[model samples]
Target: MSSAPGADAAPGSNPIPAPSATTPTTAIKRQTFSSLKVRNYRLFATGAVVSNTGTWMSRIAQDWLVLSLTGSSTAVGITTAMQFLPMLLFGLYGGVIADRYPKRKLLMLTQSTMGVLGLALAALTLTGQVQVWHVYAIAFLLGMVTVVDNPTRQSFVVEMVGPKDVRNAVSLNSANFQTARLVGPAVAGVLISAVGSGWAFLFNGLSFGAPLIGLMLMRPSELYEVERTPRGKGQLREGLRYVAGRPELIWPIVLVGFIGTFGFNFPIWLSAFAHSIYHAGASTYGMFNTAMAVGSVIGALLAARRATTRMRLLLGSAMIFGVLEMFAAISPSLWLFVGLLVVIGMFGITVNTTANSSVQLGTDPVMRGRVMSLFMMVFVGGTPLGGPLVGWVTDTFGPRIGFLSGGLVSAGSALVIAAVLVKAGGLRVRVDLRGRRVRFVEREPAGERERESVVAGVG
Candidate 1:
């Protein structure tokens, strides 16, 4: 399962420590914003914020376009499916590619390609030549590019700030993404209402420049370079074998797969709720997304404060999030639903951020790209399966049924995985009036030293 030695740090380890007293507290203790202290990361994040917002804007407009052109929620789901289906197929290969190349250069290439595609879509829509097929084709192309971009970007965070700051960087990155989620959809909705969708697409296309510039401006000498995986046959198989052997790594991914497949089917749920159940227009749809972003930003902020990722916290958040999502599904009023979305969004981010940091911290640096790809493959790639299933459920049984299914699966999967890990990790869960507690005991079959699992806060 091991790769060559002298590779970068494993994502799963807390290799980097807090700066000594000689270092300024302000530089280190900005909570989630601490990662912003890195000059490269700051520039990267600022540009990413701009680009991410535009990306969200395009997503809203694209889904809206599909709905408008076909008047079918299933068609909208197909568009979502098109974007992630490539990940299901090529994500692992992309991970291998990430390990082989410098992430910054790879990101520049991918970002430029995506921008060109966005501009093409915008041109078609503005020229009145846009159709559902065009949207589908563009989405498929974007997904193809993202197969490489997503993993490279995920693993690239380590190079920007090294492993010690990587957790903060990951949280801040999520926070940045959520911030865009807050702004993008709302603005996209208004833009769609006031003018049309073409401008939104154009904006997203142009937004890629921010990131490209950031990449170009980075001080490459300051980067924390790691050992790149040498190109060879059988390396891909070795990557898979690496993850298959680690329970700590495998469980969280399994948790993410079930959760992502069922829990993160937000596109289908939001679209169905906005268009079908509520008859809400684009503005209302944007409001739903923004409300969720509010929670997500808060969740990301909270996650940033922690130094360690815990398995218990990851599982617990999923359990609660599943329940809340179900309740949000059956909300009687739109306002109440929006409010619930805020909380659900918060819990959802906790699960996601924790899982990401945990897996990265646990894996060796050399294997970061491949393991993260596997992690994401389960987390985001599950969409190919879930998107259509949820769409079918929304179309057939109703949107509420779709929500209930996702919630049940997410909650059930977490419970099953947790139950298994209680034995595998040599832990006991005690039930009492004081609530549930998981205590680390000695590994079974022989007495051994207690392995302290560093966690942020007990769930």
Candidate 2:
């Protein structure tokens, strides 16, 4: 049976239910924790929290390990790029795999592969046989698996909660990830300082067990399975064709590519702050990350309460996030800089979560995997370019310059995207300070009034 409210109503016999200001069911679903009501999602979220924490721990440990070996921020940037490069190259192929196969089974395989890789890295580090090259190799290997894992994991949310709560589920997912970020780095910091980075890696390797167990315990009957995309020629081309026709999809991907490339060079920036600028160490680095996570959590929670994603919100938040990050780059004191990062983190998460939810919601069910794969490809995969650029900036000029440069590019990109949206959304950017007016002017179908609501948002 169709789950929509009026699905069973006779075509012309019954009076329609009035769409009122609010209803009990709608009110209940508006709550931030609404998605947790589902057993599968709850279980999966529980497992993910544990696993995401471990992932963060491994990330921090990996970067720190690289710095310790090379003493160069550029090397750290390279490591970051290497990890993401595979996703840039192969993310679409993963999407095809995702569409053709069962998502749950694919997740299990990918998750197990990740766990093994984590353990292998831990073994190498603990045995003191680890080198920057070894770390690079392992990071690249991990990214290879993530090419498949990223899209599958992203598309799996709908399977857990169905289409109705997807937005809420995605918001909660970000909240879950940020919460892990908050806890993971703090724990890893202590573990790194007290024992060594090896222990942190080992702990992360062990943390995979929780999610694996959760997956094992899920009831197959409860899974909300979408139609499996059948094998066929030109499916990949079709996915590309679908995205090409939508401006809403194109703009977000384009904007995210810029931000992800320049703005999200955090591993390089934060690492340099600790090792190069602050002269502190692992604890301070972890603290920096934790503070950012704190803001991210808050941003995610706020996103949950919002009615819908908007173009103004996305561009506005990105602009603010970039400017704040630039400001953090110039802060004179470590504490002051850390304080700035907190606010930056908030805006960053706002931009990230909003972009993700918007893209997923706007896409078709069958085409979602490919669409999201492209999104991830542009967002994380752009690291191949951004990482190296930021690294070179950090090494040639200074960490502060790298920081300032990234923010400048990020904020600039947002402005350009805003302009693109203005023209493409059938709206004009008019500044009338003398007339005391500042708002979007909706031009008649003179331009793209059509795609505006679908891509950008309603004015």
Candidate 3:
């Protein structure tokens, strides 16, 4: 259970061993930072941390800017919608572009466009000439760019360190994003309080420079080469068929869709909670986000240390997220509610990072772009469609019901999926009487069904 089949091994070799808790100090010395041993991945991670921090800052600033500009919750929802709508419409096509083009060069172009877009928004907002329409226009444009940029960036990770290090790389990528989430919002809050939202936007624009430069500086020879597929009859259909044929690919996408639509609409709920439930201002909202970011950072770090790619942990964590959200929804005190959010955020990122890593690690190298795009589409594209409904629920029924609805739906979906996976795989679930640990095992038809539990662990 510790070492997943063929995970973290040289191609065609045995899997790397899971480090033992009782191993001597001398034994530990031989282990390496498998992914970072590659120079290109190190550079990419470093640059991404710098850029991702800026992205988070902009997110916080953008939300605050919209809230300040119009005190209505609906405006914030609209801003979120404009940014995610294109992903719903064009995400699959973005996969096609990633498959057919040179991802590095495509990324360079996309990054530059993003910087320009961010700077344009900053200039507009700073001069006091910005209207709601301008924010909408900018959000839509940014979404359009991300439609292509997202898949390209996702596909680019595999090439950075290759398949052997892919799981670690993906976990580290989540860590980087979460780390940025922690810094960016705190910085944005102070900047917005002092000068205006414009400087936060400007910093985001500048953040693009790091990744752009990192892409340029990569040695082409060290990168993994994904062959470009020629345009053919039914190419996109082929990608769909490819996914349809694989349960490993299809189920994770379904799980993420459910989570994204319900569990992931945090900002919508957070904004309402801060203003209505907590009776706090912009700074309080920032603190709420920062707390979530703190939890996310911890989740990402824990995921980075994982040696297995099993889906059970992810599914269970998602269940925990739903349960915690429900706890937050009914809490009477602001401190208790914020504390619940911290736990919710922790498990939320754990579920997301685990699902993402599983899907990517399970995929074929040639098909990764298409697969990941499909994954991203379901995981992110569903947001725009769901956000308005969530927003309306928050605005109408109130924040508690909105949170309750999402939490219940998420937990229900996960329970259903867990049952299906268990039945299909003929899995046995075992519980130890003395501890909180549970073990699951896959059983052959001829095997003793009651004794099939493969391993045990603390839940």
Candidate 4:
């Protein structure tokens, strides 16, 4: 039954009352932590913090274990590459799986698999039955899980926090990860010195328990439901087609691939840089990673304070990152090298966090999983394609040249992308002084629309 209209309503119409102040304003916010206002997000964040710390611990231990066994810089490179190779080969498919499955449920399966793998690796290591090949096998297996886990985690954040709090959530996620990086290596260093690398793996296996529990405890009613799209013909090809059409999407992927392939294989470079250049031991390697983590934490905190996202800042910062990587490569002292790494770490996170947020914000909902998978592919998966080459270069020409080469290539690639984006998008880079930021402004040349039409016809 329609009630009589109030002054706010038209004739024969019912007017809805304005929501009271007590009613939350859920419509306007656009950051990631807004989901934390919901109980479920808080629980998940808490659990993830615990699990991520342990995961970092395992990463440190794994690298150390490989170095201890083979004592070859190239072996560490191989280990790192193996762990990321599956993402190169299968990340796109994993994204397709993510879009089709219930994300939370899929995460549970992947997390459990991770736990079992960690335990098996630990047992083998502790029993003195593990070989270098065994480590490679386990690392490869874990990489496969990560191929799925990474995209799922990125998309899941959107669901947990909704759109409003996405930026904050993304920053906080980086904070959590870097925080783990900060503590993980320090703890692994002490533990490895005290007991063995096996215990570190065992602890990591146990750490998965928190996230597993959090998953089990989530209430079904609280879940954010995204419509499941039917699988279409050429789904993967379609995803590629969509990305190919967008300059913002395609350029960033290209930039990330270049940086990731050339610049960010620090794990492989770290051991060599430490031993060959710095003449340091395992403890020094631990110290180097810890210092980088400290800088990363600082970057994460700074990113958390931003009220808005800026893509130009990301591009400019990426340019600086290349400069810093070059500096880190040629530093004379170990102390200077580690200090340089801190600056490098800071900018690295800035570049990564900005790129990640840009990719997520830029994609269509149905296509998001695939887009993110492609992003992960370029950012992490592409590491292997260049990892061994970087190692061989380091081993052959000296670690300094390896660093120099990576820096030059990264900077060159970024500049090329910037030029392409400027021309393709008709984008003029501008600084907004009042906003204390930089942005790209779209400028259309005379008859640009008609020109586009002519070009379209020609194509």
TM-scores for the candidates: 0.90, 0.90, 0.89, 0.86
- List pairs with backbone clashes in candidate 3: none
Q: Write the per-residue lDDT of candidate 1 for residues 350-404, one digit (tens) a residue.
A: 9988888877777776778898888888788888888888888888998888888
Prediction RMSDs, each to the true structure: 5.3, 6.0, 6.2, 8.4
Residue-level error in angstroms, candidate 2, position 110? 0.5
Please give, for residues 1-459, the per-residue lDDT of candidate 3 as tens digits. Answer: 122111112233322222221212232221234677777778777888888988888888888788778875667777888888899998888988887777878888888999999999999988989888898899889999998899888877777777656667777788788888878888888898899899988999999999888877777667765555556567678889988987766777898899898778877888788778878766777788888888887887777767666666877887888888888899998788778777887898888878787777666655667888889989988878788788888888998999999998888888888877777666766777789866666665675455443221111
- By lDDT, the better pick of 1 and 3 is 1
lDDT of each: 0.83, 0.83, 0.77, 0.76
Model 4 stretches astray by more than 4 angstroms: 1-35, 425-459
Q: What is candidate 2's lDDT per residue for 43-162, written digit by digit as tens?
A: 889999999999999999999889888889999999999999999999898888887777877888888989998999999999999989989998999999999989988987877777
Question: Could you tell which candidate, 2 or 3, scores higher by lDDT?
Answer: 2
Provide the lDDT at 117 for model 3. Answer: 94
Q: Residue 395 in model 1: shift from native, Å?
A: 0.7
Candidate 4 lDDT, tens digit per residue, 1-459?
123221112343222221121213243434434446866667777888888888888888888888889877678789889999999999998888776667788888999999999999999989989899998999999999998898888877766655545566777788788888888888888888888889989989998998889877876455554544465678889789989996657766777888999999787778788777877666677788888888888887777666554545666778888888888888988889889989988988888887777677667656677889999988999878888889888888988888888888877777776666666665665667999855555666666532221111011
Error of 4 at 425 (Å): 4.7
